[model samples]
Target: MNHAPASVWKNPVHFLAFGLGSGAVPKAPGTFGTLAAIPFFLLMQPLAWHWYALILVLSFVVGIYLCGKTSEDMGVHDHGGIVWDEFVGYWITMFFAPAGWLWICIGFVLFRFFDIIKPWPIGWVDKQVHGGLGIMLDDVLAGFMALACLQLLAYFF
Candidate 1:
C-alpha cells in the first residue's frame, strides 16, 4: 500500500483526528495495519493492566465509530487493510501478562487462531453483529478466547 500521504489530502492523521487513517492500507491492509499498532502495545507494556484495559475499552468503543466511518470513506466493507480492530483485539489477549517476545509471539498465535477459527460464540458474534461495532466485537471476543487459552498454557508449563 502507498504510504499515507504527508499533506492535507494525504495522511488520515492529517485528514482524520484519530487513527482512522491508518486503516486505509491498500493490500493485506488489515495485517499491515495491525503491524502499525505493535509499537504502541510495546510501549504500554510497563503500564498496569487496569490502565491498559481502560484504554482498550475506550478504543473498542471509539473504534466502532472510527472504523465504520473510515470504511465508508474508503468505500469498502471490512476491507483487509483496516486492522485497528486486530491491533486492539490482540492487545486484549495479551492483557495482564508479560510482554516479552515469547509471550508476544504466543499472544499473536493465539489471537490469530481465535480470529481465524471464530468458533462457536465468536462465529456467532461475527455473523450477527453489523457495522463497525460488529466488525470489532468478533475480534475482541477472539482475543478473550485467546487469552483464556494462553493463560491455561502458562499455568501448566
Candidate 2:
C-alpha cells in the first residue's frame, strides 16, 4: 500500500494514473478507481461502438505511459495507488453492457472478482509481464473476462 505523497500528485501523469485521486484512498483503491469509472461509462454509453472502442484503446495506450511514469516516480512497481488500469478495465467491462443498473452492478462485480482473483491467464500475465504493460495487462484481461460474462448473460436473459 504505497501512499504517494502530495508532491507526486503534482505530476499530470500521476494524477491521471491515480484515477483523479480516487486511487489515493487508503483502502481498496482499485475498487474506488473502478467506482470512479462508472460515471464516465454512463457518459460514454451513448457513443457508437466504434467510437467507444477508440476511446478505450486510446485510454489503454496512454495508461501504459502514465502508469509507468507514475510507478517510476513512486518507486514502486504497479503500486496499489496507480489505478488508471482499473478505470480503463471497468470501462472495457462495461462496453456494450446492457442498459440498467443491474447490468452495471454485474459488470462491476465480475471485473473486481476477476481482477482480485486473477484467474488463469490473467494471473499468468501478471507474473510474466513487467513495467507499465504489466500493470495494465492483468486488468485488461480481467475486463475481457468480465465483458465476456456480461455479454453471455445478456444473450441468455
Candidate 3:
C-alpha cells in the first residue's frame, strides 16, 4: 500500500480524491470509498434526473483533475489511496435506480463487482490509459455497466 503523507490531506484535491480520508483506511480502501459515497448518493436521490445527471457529469470532470493532481502529489499513478473515482463511479451506478435500501445495496454490490473484476474494455483502459483520465475512466465504465444491470433489474423485476 502506497500511503500518502498526513500532510496530503491538507490539500482539498487530495482530501476529496481520497474520499474524505476513507481511502486511507488501510484495508479495502476502494470499498470504503464507495461506502463513503452512499450518503451523498442519498442526498442526490431526490433531485430531478437532469440535475442528477448534471452533477454526475460535473463530478467526473472535476475528478479528472482532482485524481490526477493527487496522484502526482503522491507520485503514483492511480494510487489505491486516490478513490474519488470510486465515489463518483458508485454515484453514477445508482443513477435511475429504484428507491429503497435493497436497490442501493444491489447497486453497491454491482458497482464493486464490475470495478474489481474489470472486464473487457474496463480492464483494457485501466492498463492503457494514463493520468487523471485513466484514473476515472475505468471506474466510469464500471459504473455504466453496473447501471445497465441495475436498470435491467428494475425493468424486469
Candidate 4:
C-alpha cells in the first residue's frame, strides 16, 4: 500500500538506495530488493573471494551514504522502500558460496529468513542504532547470520 516517492525514480542515489527500483514495489519491497541483488551476485561470483570481500567493503561504505541521504530526502527513517541494505545483505550471505543454482536458492532463502526474523543481535541493533549506520548494521548482521548458516550447510552436505 505504500508508494515510493517520485524522487526514488528521479534521483540516482535514491534509485540505488531503492535497490534499482525493486524497493518501489507495493508489497514485500525488501524481498524484491534482495531478489534484485542476485544478478549482481552472479556477476561478482567469478571473482576471488578476497576481491569479492573488497567489493563488500566498498558497497557497505557507499550504502551508508546512499541509505542515509535517501532517508533524509524522504524524511523517513529506514523506510521500507530503502532497500540497499537488503541488496548488500544478500551479497554478504552468498560470500564464498559454491557456484550453483542450488546454493543461490539456499542463500536467498536463508538471507530472507534472517532478515525478516531479525534474531538476537540483529534485532537488538535494529532497535538501538539510528541513521545510515543503523540502517545498514542490522542487515549486515542478518547477512553474517545467513552466511554462517550457508557456510555450515556447505560444509556438512
Q: Residue 100 of candidate 1: its Cα lDDT?
A: 78
Error of 3 at 147 (Å): 0.2
Best-fitting candidate, scored by TM-score: 4
Model 2 per-residue lDDT tens digits across residues 1-157: 6576684468788899999998999889999999999999999999999999999999999999999888888788999988999999999999999999999999999999999999999999999998899999999999999999999999999
Best-to-worst TM-score order? 4, 3, 2, 1
Total clashes, candidate 1? 3
Kindly report which residue stretches of model 2 are placed more than 4 angstroms away from their true locations once superposed: none
Q: How many clashes in each structure?
A: 3, 0, 0, 0
Instruction: Give per-model TM-scores.
Output: 0.81, 0.97, 0.97, 0.98
At residue 22, what lDDT does model 1 achieve? 55
- Candidates in order: C-alpha RMSD to true structure: 3.5, 1.0, 0.9, 0.6
In model 1, the Cα lDDT at residue 147 comes to 87
* Winner of 3 and 4 under lDDT: 4
Which residue pairs in candidate 2 have backbone atoms (N, alpha carbon, C) closer than 3 angstroms, thus clashing? none
Q: 47, model 2: CA deviation in Å?
A: 0.3
* Residue range 50-156, candidate 1, lDDT tens digits: 88988899989877876677566656555555576887888888887664788878878788888878998999988898778887899899989988988987788
lDDT: which candidate is best? Answer: 4
Q: What lDDT is reached at residue 53 by model 1?
A: 84
